[model samples]
Target: MKKQQGLSVIAILLVLALVGAGLMLVFKIVPVYTEYGDVKNALTALSAETNVGEQTLRQEFDGKANVSGVTSVKGENLMVVAGAGSNYLRAKYQREVPLFGNVSLLFHFDTQAGQPPAQ
Candidate 1:
């Protein structure tokens, strides 16, 4: 009987620990990873428009690294350009404290000068 009770108690404690760890990871690491991915995507998109369109993107967070880049490359079959512009560029990069910080970026977004957002 005591052995069974002890086993049950151990199981409960293990479950609680797992939950706590999950919460911490969720609040910390996720946001930063997300922000990084977003930056990559936005830059890629901005590079697509070339000299013709105004791209608007948001900075994910306001911090020391709140920076965005734009570049263009020409290939035999495809031309690639990506990055946001001054008038239309915007984004919010957020680093959640613990776990969620790794993936806090809610989304990666970029827009051309004329088209509207998808519904």
Candidate 2:
């Protein structure tokens, strides 16, 4: 009986551990996907904005939006940039790990090309 009880406890603990990991991935990784999804929708709006090709499109727009977990904090610039002579849009972003260790989500939008980046 004692051995059975111990095994049961261990099994329960294992299950809990698995659940915790799932939650962490859900909470952490899901947001990244969610933010990216929003950015994806935004990209649909940007197809006409590109004077170059899809390579440039992906380079300049797709996977290039500067996004984080929360708002009101400074983050890296992950914008897709267009270069000269077949230079297409490319993903570009700045990586800024919080010094204070506070994670923030920020989204940067470059509304106009060949102009100053806004937000």
Runs with alpha carbons beyond 4 Å of true place in candidate 1 = 1-6, 52-119
At residue 46, give the lDDT of candidate 1: 42
- Among all candidates shown, the one with the greatest lDDT: 2
For model 2, residues 10-58, the per-residue Cα lDDT tens digits are 8899999999868765576555556545554444445446356545565
TM-score of each model, in listed order: 0.37, 0.41
Worst 10 residues of 2 by lDDT: 88-97
Deviation of model 2 at 101, angstroms: 10
Model 1 per-residue lDDT tens digits across residues 9-34: 78899999999988876765555565
Native-to-model Cα distance after best TM-score fit, residue 81 in candidate 1, in Å:
10
